[model samples]
Target chain A: MDSITPNEIDIVRASSSKINEIDFENLAFGNIFTDHMLMCDFRDGKWQKPTIKPYEPFLLDPSAKVFHYGQAIFEGMKAYKDESDDVWLFRPDENFRRFNASAKRMAMPEVPEDIFLGGLHEILKIEKEWVRKGKGNTLYIRPFMIAIGTGVIAAPSTQYRFMIILSPAKSYYSGEVKVIIAEHFSRAANGGIGAAKAAGNYSAQFYPTKLANDKGFQQIIWTDDATHTKLEEAGTMNVFFRINDTLFTAPTSERILDGVTRKSIISLAEREGIDIQVRSVLVAELVEAAKNGSLKEIFGAGTAAVVNPIVGFSYQDEYFELPKIENSVALKLKDKLTNIQYKLEEDTFGWTVKI
Target chain B: MDSITPNEIDIVRASSSKINEIDFENLAFGNIFTDHMLMCDFRDGKWQKPTIKPYEPFLLDPSAKVFHYGQAIFEGMKAYKDESDDVWLFRPDENFRRFNASAKRMAMPEVPEDIFLGGLHEILKIEKEWVRKGKGNTLYIRPFMIAIGTGVIAAPSTQYRFMIILSPAKSYYSGEVKVIIAEHFSRAANGGIGAAKAAGNYSAQFYPTKLANDKGFQQIIWTDDATHTKLEEAGTMNVFFRINDTLFTAPTSERILDGVTRKSIISLAEREGIDIQVRSVLVAELVEAAKNGSLKEIFGAGTAAVVNPIVGFSYQDEYFELPKIENSVALKLKDKLTNIQYKLEEDTFGWTVKI
Candidate 1:
């Protein structure tokens, strides 16, 4: 039934390189792209030949539905280069599955597993130089699908373009990371597109996050909409709380992204025999824990920042700071995750997918 | 800071004409486009001179954040041409206000009322012929804002572009609608981006709406996330249910859009001395009403399809059909609203904005 042989793809080297133009050190999270990108079109009811070409603009009509209706979905994962110059992906299969999950929510065509994995391999392999060799340095791969049909219908676009662009990056957030727990705003709702990494989810967050930034917090911890008591996620990153000797994180809900890192950390925590709870952590309970000296550390977990320690958080006009300790779980988890990513630690769980 | 003089505005009409290329009779919702478009850049922290230019492709860098992070917001409203050749907008001011509200949520810049109104006026005035004259026909104007700065920072974009594009003619949804009352799905969440017509909100909906479509329902009536028992809205339209001759519509919340037509319908119902309830209507209550013959009608209100009555609805595998009435509020309100829109009736509420 497969007309085109599996693993068949076209390759074209970039005529020129933007590698010289992008400053590796000053690179922001997702902005500066590498020399080449992977692109494929879904037409005639199937994905066409995947192609790797120079990262440049396409001749898309302005009336493309994606620009108008937001018929777009994207995935965020990184490719790390270890000491031996070998590149690795921390369970890109999970990202592929999550990407399809997002696509299903947005009514986009689900990319075949082979196509998604092939696209990623094709992109990272060609732009291997974009993978920076150092701690907190990696090639951020942005795999996105956009509705490019030249029409403005308030419906789903029939045609789509799936592309994977690589960017050399450092930590998304620099310096001390602080956040506010949102009780007044929601990123998404149950029975809504909250679980999908559709483009609008991040855009929906910019305002509230900006307000938090204005209040001296680097990010926001979105709480459940009904009562605003149960912590959902950091929206972009899954959140973990360290209370005394035990660690707790909110279980995945329809409203929170089932983050790749969030799940991995759960496995890692179990391997190390640390006490952990995957349940709703009420904000009131967390505040009480902070006041009772039971809160040891609170950090965000995600692909961008493996473990971002939260310095302080404001909730209901009350500010609370978690006590810092020399023996902190955030520091230890960060080391373990990074070591697995950089190939310094044993891949006990086989989480590392070598490209 | 009033700067733009209409006489000095740079105007360049689209050289290519796609209007003739389109089949008006067979037109599908937002798929076709007209010739000209309006654009004004936000640079140096101020809106630049607005330009009416040819509708064409945009020269965007590959790293434009809108493609990845979904940094965009938009407003949907229509311009109606009366039999006497007068073009009117139904409460365009409400659209402008809501647009900014969405802008605030997405962290896009607020478009000044004057600029937004002035731009639409200019565009509509120039493309007057494209504003179809037939009943139930109009020019759909899409006013949108997109983050333009090509930086990959996972933060708010520094630069933005406010644009107005025109799509000629036809209703979005065809025929009498059948809806499914949501029990497990939600449109927006409390303190979430539900109230805003942000682009992401729409993208997030495509997949869920598809599920409803597959279930043989044309659209869905989204319910509150807290319990998923109370009815909120249709996919794109505000919902209204009639029980024992009393009109009831859910109050706009942080999770519901303050629809322009919705407010108009409320006022029209009140002015006509019709009993109305602006409160939550539980889904079970409506389903029970359907069982007991207390439910009269279910209608959806929005810009595209003024007031669409749901012929039937299904919940928990039980289907209920709304009996066709001699003069349903859905039909009456639709006529009244369209009359005011087409300048056939008195603009008692002053919703008509003459172009």
Candidate 2:
């Protein structure tokens, strides 16, 4: 194994597959897993040869750094099966690049392109049946890294593990999501770790999200740290707002994540000649637009939900409801993106890669 | 086991101790572990009875939530053995209370007081030899909680593991420290998990601290997230300043941790009839005082260091050196706290608890 280059991946197949036991029609988003997974270890100054092994539990020391210091990062993507039983991935290179970027911000080691992309390609080919063929059914691909150093110190770990897990996912949200604009809580500060897809970033929102859930909202539109007046994101997704026919969204900054789905939507809208404005959106301006009926639509973009439409939002004890429309921007964009993902349309953008 | 109440702890002794192989004189701060550890599980909507067992590896699923979402929290404390072979702890109640407070912030179930205190008492008595005698030698105690649910969804875990591990420590810092005032990076935000001892809060500071280290600074003095003017904290410790015989420190807030050592020093200063000002220490005012020769001293307070004196600070590329004093306030406070911890002097506040 030490003699092998990073691209020369080793394979270890599981004795059997659990596919027959899984009920695809009644599947939860992330509860079911495929037979095989990809793993690589960072040791002796570099990443070793990648390996595809059986998915199993690890016998780790209780003092592993990830259990104490939270030096962990992850990426989310999806694998879809086309009508012709061909497997395709949407913009996997973007996720590959972003994963290394996240590792750098957390002071962790970067995974080489050969290892990350090559391992992902090989694993998807082995577990191709996991990718269900349907409009909304797909295999959710999770690429994650963790600090595995067996020392109970508050510092960067010298050892790490990078692994990829696949789960069958249905549509993330069943209906239009309702959100509340954060008035006091903040997600990340300027020059903070908010831009990285760190594990801690997601857990920090659970308590505040529960608060919003109790008040009848499914998510929160995080605002600026200095003043909760400018909307930044909506619970792990990048937010976009429409006033009349113009679209407005907060630009990627040190305080907001640069999502792959968000950038794809921007490119799609620009090609379609849609008026898109990527700038800081003030909460007051959004509320005013909603009151005056110019706020035509709101939606979020992410891997879990390619396009999640927002039906209403609450701010400062006042709720503003968005009217339902036929052929809305969100509906149109979701359809277009899904069609491209499933290879239903021509590969004009060349975004899909077949395994 | 299911019938046992939360207060009834079960003890499982180690087959043998590793005391003979240890070098107490050359111990690192958090590397050497004791023979036994305390662990408890949280399931079925409540904390199970605590158990003491040999320290060893844990068999965990690859998808434990703590490794992916970072739902983890911890507390730091110490145990000292007096010259008479009796062990004592300083204000363990404070740590117990704060641990649960952190749990609530991260949406984790709280560890009952009975379980926390009861387990500590039992484990300390069982591993009494690990607590070394004499000053500057002690047992560092780490009590931590982690989400153990084996799922890939971004939600709070239904299963949790709360454990306590002890390590032999020989002081944290050696010399008078040098620090740099943070101007670009923020430790946390107003509505963030900074106040809680969340694992992510500590890991987020590692990259920034490395930058300061590259510039020959031992630590960083973080400032307000909105405006880098008011001082918040220094590394893992709360900072204090003295100018013309008057002491000043920042008041605790949502962005600053409510440190046990910080509050203890404040009480000690008040009892000693020192003029202490608990308010925001602006950067402009501090710089002005340093230039006018009124800035007497600077130091940091925390459980690990007790009191660490600072010799200099750099801000905006300019350095400010503090004067060395024969009887500095930092020195006095450190002596008082350590004396009480080791049972060498009268614990006037009844802070020392015998094990």
Top candidate when judged by TM-score against the true structure = 2
On a 0 to 1 DockQ scale, where is model 2?
Answer: 0.78
Q: Which stretches in model 2 have alpha-carbon errors above 4 Å?
A: A1-7, B1-7
Query: Could you tell me how far off, in angstroms, the CA of residue A346 lies in candidate 2 after the best superposition?
Result: 1.8
- Which stretches of model 1 miss by more than 4 angstroms? A1-7, A20-22, B1-5, B16-23
Give all TM-scores, in the order shown: 0.95, 0.97
The TM-score measured for candidate 2 stands at 0.97
The DockQ of each candidate is 0.67, 0.78
Query: Model 2's CAPRI class?
Result: medium
Q: Give the per-residue Cα lDDT of candidate 1 at A276.
A: 86
| Candidate 1: Cα lDDT at B40 | 85
The lDDT for every candidate, in the order shown, is 0.82, 0.88
TM-score of 1: 0.95
Which candidate has the highest DockQ of all? 2
